[model samples]
Target: MATYKLDCNGGSGNSYKLALYLNCAGLDWQPIGVDFAGGQTRDPDWRAGTNTMGEVPVLEVNGQRMSQSGAILIWLAETTGKFAPAGTVERFEALRWILFDNHKFTNNYAMHRFQVSLTAEPVHPAILSFLRSRAEASCAIVDKHLMDRPFVLGERPTIVDFSMAGYMYYPAEETGFDIETDFPALHAWRQRLAGLPGWKPPYELMPVGSSPPVRVVTQTA
Candidate 1:
C-alpha cells in the first residue's frame, strides 16, 4: 500500500491541491478516485465512513483519514519540511494566504466554474454573477500582492502557493476567467509554480473523465 491514499474527485480543485503537493513533494501516495458525479460521495454510508463533511481529497494515512486541503497541506509541510514557511513571520503569512484562498480565492472561483462549466443543470444568472464578482475581487487582491513576488511568500514557493493554485490550472473556458489578461501578475506567478519539479496539470494527476487532458498553457508568454 502507498504511504498515503488520497480519496479524490477528479473534478474537484480541492483534490488537485493535495495531489499537487504530494506529487511535488515526491511523496509515496496513491489517488483513490471517488465517483462524485455518481452521487457516491453524498451517500450516507460514504459520508459516515469517509468524511462526515462530505468532501473529497480526504487523505488517508495508516487508515486514519484527514480532510480539508489547507489542514492537510499544513501537515504535509510540517512533516516533510519541503514547502514550509521559513520563519515565524512567514508561517503566519502562509496561514493568512491559505485562509484567504479557502474563503475567497478558490471558494468563489471553484463555485463559479462549476456553475459556468461543470454543472449539468443551468445555474441562475444572478448566482453566477455573484460568484464571478467575488472570484474576480479575490483574484485582483492576490494579483496585486504577487506583483513583486515570485511566489506567495516572496522568493520561494510555500504550501500557500499550493493552496492558491488549486483551480488555476484548469482551462480558461472552464474557469470563465482570462487570468492572463485580467490578472497578469497572478498569471506569472502560476507560471513560476508550473516550472517547479514534478509539477503536473490537474487532470493528468487524477482520474477525471474520458476527455483528453487539456494542455496547460502558462500565461507567461
Candidate 2:
C-alpha cells in the first residue's frame, strides 16, 4: 500500500481536484491540512520549506513532493496505470481541455467565487460582473462539449473530466452559478462523476470548512 499525503484546505477547488482523483482511484491517502485561511502560504519560510511556489494540494509520497494539480494528476495516472487517456489522440485531447480548464474554466469561476463569497472586503461590482461573464462564456463551451459526450473524451472518464469537474461540485451559493438548472449537460456530467467509487464532496474529505475561506485570497508582493 502506497501512503499519500496531500496538503490542502477545504475551500480550495484546486486541492479538491487531486483529492477527488485520489479517492475515486481508490488510493491510500490522507489530506494534510494547510492553514490557508491564516496566511500560511504567504509566508516565505513556509514556502521555502514546503512549496517554493506557495500553493496547497502538495502531494507527498515516497519522499517526493509534487505541486500543480494538473501535473500531479497526470503523474498519478501514469504511476497507477489508471485514467491515463486511452492513446495518443486522447492524450492530446486531454491536454487541450486541461489547458482550457486552467486558463478559463476553473480560473474565471474561482476568481468570481473568491470575490463573491471568500474575500474579506466586497469586490467592485463591475469586476465581479466581468469575471462572472467570462466564467459563463467558458461554461457554455463546456456544456456544449458535454452534450455529445458522456465525458470530455467520450463515454469513459479521464483526467480531463477530473480537471474540468474541479469547481462543479461547489455550491451555487458559493460559486454564484447553479449548473443543476443553468447548465444541464455539465450538471449531468458531474452527477456521473459523483456516482463513481470512493467519491466524496470537497469539504467532506478535507478537515476544514468551506465558508469564509481558509484565508482572504490576496496577491503576494
Candidate 3:
C-alpha cells in the first residue's frame, strides 16, 4: 500500500478530481484540510513543504510533493496504472482534454463562480459576461463530443472523465448555465461516475459547512 497525502479545500473542482480518482482507484490516502477562508494555504509550513504556490489539492506521495490539479491527476493515473489508456494516441487525447479543462473550462467558470459567491463586491458585467460565454462555448464543444459516446474516450472511462467530472460536479446554477440541457451525455456521465465504488465528493476536504451550497439548475437543451 502506498501512503498519499492530499491538501485540499472543499468546493474546488480541482481538489474533488483528485479525491474522486483516489476513491475510484481504491487507493489509501490521508486528506489534509486547508482553510481557504483563513488563508491557511499561505502558512509557512505549507509554503515550505506541500505547496510553495499556496494552492489547494497538493499531493504528497512517498515523501515527494506535487501541486497543480491536472499534474496530480496525471501522476496518480500513471503511478497507479488505472484509468489511463495504454495506447499513445489515447493517452495523448486524455492529456489534451485535461489541459483543456484546466486552461479553457475551469479558468473561466471557476473564476466566475468564485467572484460571484466568495467576493464581497459585485462582479464587473464585462468580465462576468465574457467568462459566462467562454464557459458556455466550452460546454458546447464537450456536448458535441459526448453526444456520440458515454465517455470522452468512448466505451470506457479514463482520466479525462475524472478531470472533466470535477468541473461538472458543480450545479449549473452556480455557473449561470444548465449542464444537462447543454450536455446531456455529460449529465449521464456524471451519474455513471457517481455509481463508481468509493466515490466521494470534495466535501471531505472541508471541516463542515465551510463552503457554500451548490446551486441547482435545470438542464436546458
Best by TM-score: 2
Q: Output the better candidate (1/2) by lDDT.
A: 1
Tell me how far the alpha carbon of residue 55 in candidate 2 is from the true structure, in angstroms, after superposition: 0.8
By TM-score, is 1 or 3 better? 1
Query: Mind giving the per-residue lDDT tens digits that candidate 3 earns over 49-142?
Result: 6678888778888878889888888888888898877689898998889889898867766776765555655567787677677777877787
lDDT for predicted candidate 3 compared with the true structure: 0.74
User: In model 2, where do residues sit more than 4 Å from their true spots?
Assistant: 209-221
Better of 1 and 2 by TM-score: 2
Ranking by TM-score: 2, 1, 3
Q: After superposition, how far is residue 177 of candidate 3 from its true place, in Å?
A: 2.8
Best by lDDT: 1
Q: Judge candidate 1 at residue 31 and give its lDDT.
A: 90
Using lDDT as the measure, what is the rank order of every candidate, best first?
1, 2, 3
Judged by lDDT relative to the true structure, which candidate is superior, 2 or 3? 2
Off by over 4 Å in 1: 208-221
Model 2 clash pairs are: 37-214, 37-215
Model 2 lDDT at residue 207: 68
As a whole number from 0 to 100, the lDDT of residue 105 in candidate 3 is 68
Clash count per candidate: 0, 2, 2
RMSD (Cα, Å) for all candidates, in order, is 4.2, 4.2, 3.3
